[model samples]
Target: MTVDPFAKGGLHQAEAILKAHGVDAYFRSMAARTGDSHAVIDGRKVMLAGSNDYLGLSTHPAVIEAAVNAARRLGTSAGGSRALSGTLDLHGELEERIAAFLGQEAAVVTTTGFQANLALSALLGRSDIAFLDARVHASLLEAARLGWGRVRRYRHLDTAHLRELLAAAPDDAGRLVVTDGMFSMDGDVADLRALRDAADDFGAKLIVDAAHDMGVLGNRGAGLAEHCEVEDGLDLITATFSKAFASIGGVLAGPAGNVHYLRSNARSILFSAALPPASAAAALAALTVVETEPERRTRTLDLAEGLHNGLRTLGFDTRPSTTPIVPVRFADLAAGGAFWAALFRAGVFTNLVAAPAIPGGGAMLRLTLTANHDETHLATVLEAFDTAGRRLGVPRGPDLPPVRLTRGDGRRAGRR
Candidate 1:
């Protein structure tokens, strides 16, 4: 008899658990009308609390115009890798814009933020001892795994533990300390200043994946390094244009010589096609918006604060998060699935994170915010949570209103 490779592994186990809980709703297809605060899921219009479009620039008129203009001028795709025929003037413009925005000497754009991390990991960790945070993004972890280096993971957000790990490593070994500027799942900002200090003390190069922080943190939206007032201390910074920039690409920015080295040595950059002309233009335009419209950042942060407070008041455990990505924790996968379905039925869409994605094998409803969300939107979200929490038997604080189910037409379907 032939054996199925996945029949005995984690995939098979996951299937079993998903089946048991009827939680397959988590994987169902949902489409957004635009990258806005609402989406169409299973033909129902739902509020989008799960998106990464922090500044709400995804649907901005100028960004759309720039993408259209670039496509009209340079065709749809780059047609080749940057090493060959793919390097467009638009790409160079985006790189310059990013470098200028971040106060970095140079910047290199890649196909995705994940690819940027992968390329850096392959290059920087090839001969170094890579000390990674336990909760870093999977892309960085995969990069470390692929590189020919020894990898050690310390407790999440524990700089003291990080120092211990650094102290244990060989004195002569090339060391690389990698972490996320703002952890995506937990929504917590990293102590970049302390991490930079640790790196300096141990002679390790610090790489910060600021994908979640770009356009959301700092005075001018320059990201975590700027937010921490340690812009000059970081050795390298990587971020994605997909989130706040409302475009699809990633950037690695740093000293000119280091960026030049990545351009010449990173295999992903050499082998993969460059970012499309439309994406490059869109990213550049989005950067312009980030620089010009400071209120968008302020509004986004304000809305996030409102939601975080509301959730906490209702007795949800949203830990260690101070950013737009807020995760409401649950005890297990079943409870998370039920809570997610309850919210979905109530016309609020959120990302349900479960085992394998979440650390420590728990689950959470990953709620994110955008500047487009208004006071009414926040009110509606809080109301939905109240209803969902009640129906699911989750604990709640006092003074919340009774449960009400919302129909597809945005009217109250029924009251419980």
Candidate 2:
């Protein structure tokens, strides 16, 4: 069918495409919540298995009290950009605490994770060559675009390919190699060790977006860099507070001078309002949770094991996931949508990933686990998956051996 170019049905066309592709997203409002375990969505208590709340501090008394107290003391908003009057005491304290937690010399908090990448890339990426992993977050890609850098994408988690690109790029140009410490969708940790080696060989500074790694990996949830023994190897580490920190902001942790440079040169930070008092305070409190609660990390891995093993035993193709996020593989969009819908009807909520998120035939259900999920919660999530799997007629276990879930840096070399 031929369609008009300037018609009044752009919205209709978009909706048609969504329907054609079986993208029926449910818009349920959540009213109450607690940790990674459970929440009240649409007035019904649903096990929240898909949150990045790795440490389950989202509803912790300390985090909640910190936010509440901060709002009471400083009001709701910062009202100005960080460059202006928005650089409040709370932001300063959070930055200091976060930097210390991540083993960095300094940190700068931004309005969101996207802003953190946008600002840092803008500052550090002059006429440099940026070698990014193919699956790196969109924020980093956007930042590269804004930074006006020579952007080259290496195969996802392929260190040798990245090395070739870095070697071929002009050595005289500033060099920044960016990757996600833990890939968001697939829930697989990056090959930071290999990436670091390549970066060092080529003299390219390494930047890790640890949004999924923070508060989930490492001895004290310091992130993939610390877990992979590359905390110092990386030149910069950026993460989002909205995930494990349970707040609405992002922070860039690295050398004090680089952060200072970002503060001065990054337009995103200069133009956007700083993170509000409540978010800053909550993030500060969350850092305490990360430091004190080692069991949260343990529980996170345990829960991940339960769900990963459960689904695998039921015969669904869950990809190699050592982290809390697992992608249940489907041959195409049809099966993915059917599985997603079945899971929803079975009273479990998971992120449905399809085209644009995955390769054309690589559609899958992205299941995210949290440390807060107890056996009961995980069982419920698995039961839903089993139901969905049966309906979709997808084969259960693979011919390959069972993938064991382990702790301490889920990186198996060349396994990506």
Candidate 3:
């Protein structure tokens, strides 16, 4: 009667397979901290090649100080849900700060990025249709399922497919187009201008999940809309502070009326507890750093470029990456596990993305770069990868079936 999915199902089988391949890299608890960019795993000081701390501000003195100060001043928790007694001054300040930063009329903070995406629950009516990108985060998919709207999935980063789907929808149907600013695993960017054109032509509201892009891209660090110069074209933008901001919370920013509507009707935000004061303060501090320190983002992207080129030179397939996230494709799951084990031995830790996370049955090493990582770190990582591949006899890049480019945008790929 008490069946555990992880113990008895597909995940279990995958675990067995990984174990057979001698991969001990899956879930090691962090025992000690070696700054934001490095972690002590199994007592070995390894660099975090798979972390989401893009700007590496998690360990910044200012960010930590702000969190500590807030905790000291205002207790730990928010004490209640936003709809109840949980709303705090720090929350409002962060919301305002985020709204201004993103050039939005208003913003509402949520406890998690997943919950922030659930704002669609309030916006998607029974007669509405949600056009989703295939490579979007699972949160948006869950939101579409929870909402009253019908969901239609288009190819990842493919505005042409999105346009076709939109054209097929009922003319009177409320259209909501959803996509990621930067795909988490693929590391590719959405052509916002092209997407905006498609949405506008089809009379749709555009919603972007900029979880990986916020505080990482754009000249002003406002995420994809700003980076693509389509801020005015977007109807709503949702993102988490966990990545580049080095904080723990999410925000939904858009028009004043839309935000107010979501705040009032989105059950995910209304019923759930509000973000803690410490998180809010830390996010505020991180935002300040993100604004003042443009070099962090520049360094981050540049490092990613260098690392990506290095991987290519080593014959690893980094698929369609234009962001800090780079995923190296492998022949199969077993090859990936062996590579992971080898990298772990080499004192570099990277995440392994396998089936379920992806549509097709394959594995990829999903590594992300941060601003704090330098040339030395890059060299170490590249060297480790080289050793792992050569020793494991792993299949290299451009040899696999590439995501065929359909349009001139060069970002059109992904399917179910």
Q: Write down the RMSD of all candidates, one decimal each.
A: 6.8, 3.2, 4.1
Instruction: Kindly give the number of clashing pairs for every candidate.
Output: 0, 2, 0
In model 1, which regions exceed 4 Å deviation?
1-3, 8-16, 31-36, 124-127, 396-416
Q: Please identify which of the two predictions, 1 or 2, would achieve the higher TM-score against the true structure.
A: 1
lDDT of each model, Cα atoms only?
A: 0.83, 0.79, 0.85
Please give the distance, in angstroms, between residue 415's alpha carbon in candidate 3 and its true position after superposition: 21
User: Whose TM-score is greatest here?
Assistant: 3
**Which has the better lDDT: candidate 2, or candidate 3?**
3
What TM-score would each prediction reach against the true structure?
0.91, 0.91, 0.93
Q: Which stretches of candidate 2 lie over 4 Å from their true place?
A: 1-23, 34-36, 123-126, 409-416
Report clash pairs, candidate 3: none
Which candidate would rank higher by TM-score, 1 or 3?
Answer: 3
- Candidate 1 displacement at residue 120 in angstroms: 1.5
In model 3, how large is the Cα lDDT of residue 51? 90
lDDT of 2 at 96: 86
Highest lDDT against the true fold, candidate: 3
Give the per-residue Cα lDDT of candidate 1 at 399: 49
RMSD versus native structure for model 1? 6.8
Model 3 spans with C-alpha error above 4 angstroms = 1-10, 399-416
